[model samples]
Target: MNNISVIMIAHNKKEIIKSQIEQLSSIHNISMDSITIVDNHSSDNLCDFLVSQSRLNYIICDDKIENYSLILNTCISEFVNTQNDILILDPDSFLLPETLKKLSCALNPDNGIYAVCPQNILDISNDIHSFSAALNYVNNNDVSKINLFKIIKPEINTILLSHKLLSEHTLFDSEIISDELCLTDFCINNILNDQFTYMADNVYQYYIGNHNSYYSPTNRNCDLAYIRQKWHMNYINTIPSSNLISMINEPIDKELNVLEIGCDCGATLLAIQALYPNSTLYGIEINPISAEIASHIASVKTANIEESVDLWNDIKFDYILFGDVLEHLRNPSKVIHNCRHILKKKGKIISSIPNLMHFTVLHELINGSFHYTDTGLLDKTHIHFFTYNEIIRMYEENDFNVINTIASNVTPMLSKKDSEFIDALTKLSSHKNDMLFKAFQYITLAEIKDT
Candidate 1:
């Protein structure tokens, strides 16, 4: 086993830091001297607590240095030459006994694995609060079972990074500002160099802090913009659309042909392939850069959906998916009409369209202000808007029979204040419903009418 040095950052989290150090001290093959705590000038007498502990290494940062990426880079630079590996741990996260062993097994430096992270229970849900609570919860459950490992960009919570990789290259892009984005940029650079990052499914970690607040709104947005500028494409387009995925009713093992219009970076298509492994996937993305990325996973064509009808003349698909694509079309009805020719006789169409009747849009209209944002219900590129009924009507009018309508609500269950407003609106209007205010998008399934 190679020597692994641990680095943790502290910012006013005295109790969490105490728990972190206790957990770190219990891990096998790790000594008290190997852990370095960089205190970001905590006011909770955390430094005083650290001073009492003998054999522990600690550094007190000046109050002026607030950037997390910069602090982490400084620590990595100092330890890169001496340590065989470095483990960056979050202050509020607790690792299980087997986490390091699992992560070490996955991080085969001979196979060019640059970084590996344990599966975080907090990533699955937000119900668990602290280390003790999480430990109690997992104790009652089985821990031997494991899921398949995933290849993903590294997040800064509990990743074990290779010292060799860090020494040969820059540790983190301090310009990214946030630890997550900084590490993600480093992981991407490693990937481009034929190295990889893996998520160890069998290893488990529990996170309790509000990690979302690690980056300020301004800095996060700027970091995202910097990443977008560097990647030469919109980063958000790479996220798979769950609304559309939930509407897919096909058998998981069935062999079929799937086509996604406005597929962006083919994330949705790749997700479909994951579910329906025998399915042949295709994508129609307008952005050439996104299409190029999509091409690696699916048969992608870089062309506008309306003008590319003849592009698939030689092919027919079992399922045609429109994942928030219709509203962006200049003539959505014409495009839907044209899709009939390329669809199989009994083919179904699944679409996830933003609901214009959502409360947020209604609230903006009530205030006499209708503005377009970069993305959302009133995205600047959207040429048409539709309510749930209108979306169903569009397909029915296009000679298709509506099969199902699944509402995807971003808002939580209505609160008393929300219910009261909805009740008042229901008394004044016939078009009002509780779902209308709750559902941000509607996923509709349609099949061509038998002639």
Candidate 2:
């Protein structure tokens, strides 16, 4: 039988650490001796509090070390001296009592399960959706054969690593300051080398927060802008030029005219140009800074996309793309109506909106917090939310027919198995008896009717 050691690392998470510990304590079946916490120079009195707890063995590291992988490896090593099975946890991750036990039972010492992650319930926040979006993009259809290493690079939270696996791979590299991609890089390399098999099942809940290593407020507002631009540019350069040939559902042979509403930095427009050599793309942006960036990127790529929202009235388009933009608008319906007017007969509008009804959002609302962020369904800039029905209604109301709808990030709620419990909780939180489930958002396509 494998003995389990839960290793948790923390920095400035003092405010939530005590509650996390308490929650861990309340876990019914786990032995009290199995948990360990490492505080890596938290400026607060988190260390003192942990030391006083009789149930936990705590370690305090010097303040100078800030990289999470180093702190994580140290905690695992210090607690599980022998090659015991270990579960690494982020401070914000919460687990049910039976979670660890289930994981332990599933581990095969022969094939050696590299790591197992619980079905994550992400806390809604800015850039949280980007990760969610990426997850949705990968898991959209049949994910059984999806290349895990190619799709998801490792990062922090909800990973269980075997001691043998750790020893063979060596401790996480301390030199990588950027926590965002380091762990994922390690996981990919190791998985490719067949060091261990990565097995993720449904077990834990992740409280999405602004403090995650990559999406900090400073990075979201600035660094991410550059990163997204590069990602977009790379995406553009990779596709074949012939892929740009215009193919609206319509059979029209007229030169294709494309409109990209809310074209942030024109990366997608540039991509469209490369894909459809004969097409003319137009970009419409609301933010001047982003618009200027788009124009600059266009110039740099030598992509020809007529840019201007001022020309909205005179221009016509065979295809218009919303590209993760509609949900941010105060009135997405109004925007759709406007797009309908400018679209030629049978022209299609393609969009990718976050599914506001995603299971993660439903999980959060039931738990009693609906904090909004600068991105995703709750982005500070977003004034509207949509469901499949709502989006269909909006298009139908605008004299457009709903042609196709693809539900992404459609993972079921971690707590959904307990529908009765969820219903009971919903009743308790009801004002006038509405379930009030918050969806993550959805993407849809609609076509304007011919006269």
Candidate 3:
């Protein structure tokens, strides 16, 4: 009857298991009652060590259970009678002393499931077991440590599931042979069902293994593609019925001729068409596939889809939109300069750039590693990183006057104390020099300069 139950599924990670188990056992507030380990058919004597320690309950898989889903489901099924909060941990995952405490503090009955470390480095070498193994490799000297006591979106590894919620949602997708989408699909499905809110924050330190190919860049890329597909499939259906128009600050006006750069799938364009039916909308995109999809969406919406044109061209436009596009460009300034030229006097340019300097990223950066992933500032396709001031300067230098700037309030991924620690470090770094220049993203509305 401990507050948490830690479950780990390991294959042949003999070298790291002892240390990982030792670290978990040492957590200040957690008890032995909160832990369980499932060793899938391993060649090493992992079972003997677990039995020797007598510290954790271990389940060994025989030839009867061959797949990961069966192993995971079997383990969870056994824990069903425990009636304790369950945490799924990878064998290579190393927990900081305060990790569980912070994660527990962030857990809420309202949020269906929670994860301490939402995203970490995947060790592709672990793919032989059909599970994606990840490591939290932060350059501690360079990156700041994160506090995990904050209620936030669940991260990639390390999930916390309530016993009751587990009963309601059933177990992980045992059918998905690859662990790639099992957890995510389950969580997203539950979230959509309003069964539980998926909360994640950076709470665990992962020591990635290179023994398998689960984390190889290629596999990671494939996982990302799958994630995006899942995300789109699960969430895209809600778009047409969603109240997205309210998210836009100013509605697209019928009198204005608009240019939307990076019009992916026409979600933004279609939304604009709904708002201002008479407005002429133009889109520029680099991905032909996405462009085709967007064109199709536009056609369905009965909105005009113009031929793809480079922004550097001299075509005049009444309004230009960099909508979630600036961060992807190598030289955002060049695009801004070109936009300045095309915009008529008093024209507006509205843009949305993902904030790379968000507190989560700041926390990750302070920890010392910058790894690209499926999402966030490190998105593989992004070429430029800008802070709030840099964004303003980029526009101002190109003869555009900033009319309005809105900074979205985001929840911190770390606990208040850890966030404060990061904030202190950020301030110290800023005072020593200017650090606001590293803001995550900037949303700007600028006016073209008069000749």
Best-matching candidate per TM-score:
1
Candidate 2 local lDDT, 1-451, one digit each (tens): 2366777777777777776766666753445567777777777887788878887778787645355566666676666756677777777666544555556655554664566655453532234344345345334433233111111222335666666777666777554443453454455445444443333434334554553563245533443344345333211111111112232443334467887776655556655553455677677765554455455333212221222233655667888887767766667777777676677888888877765555456667869978797555667766677766678888888888877765554436445565554455457663422223433444466788766
Model 1 misplacement above 4 A: 49-59, 81-83, 109-113, 122-142, 145-156, 163-170, 190-196, 233-239, 265-281, 292-301, 309-315, 341-345, 413-418, 448-451
Maximum-lDDT candidate:
1
lDDT of each: 0.76, 0.57, 0.57
| TM-score for each of the candidates | 0.83, 0.43, 0.46
Winner on lDDT between 1 and 2 is 1
Candidate 2 matches the true fold with a TM-score of 0.43
Query: Per-residue lDDT of 1-451 in model 3, one digit per residue for the tens?
Result: 2577777777776667776766666644555645677666667877677777655677876443244556678777675345666777767656544556655665665653333343342332333232222222332322234433222123334666666677566677555443435554565455444443333334444445442423246544554566556454312211221222333444445455667776654556655655666666677665554455455434212221233234434556666666666776667787677665567778878877777666567667878977887566788777888777678888889988888765643443547775566567667764532234234455677888777
Q: Where is model 3 more than 4 Å wrong at Cα?
A: 28-33, 51-55, 62-66, 80-82, 111-155, 194-206, 210-451
Instruction: Summing lDDT over every window of 10 consecutive residues in candidate 3, give the lowest-scoring window.
Output: 234-243
Report the C-alpha lDDT of model 1 over 326-378, residue by residue, as the tens digit.
Answer: 99888898888888888889788899889997777877888898999988999
Q: What is the lDDT of residue 213 in candidate 2?
A: 63
Tell me the deviation in Å of residue 255 in model 3.
Answer: 25
For every model in order, what is the number of clashing pairs?
0, 16, 33
10 residues in a row with least lDDT, candidate 1: 147-156
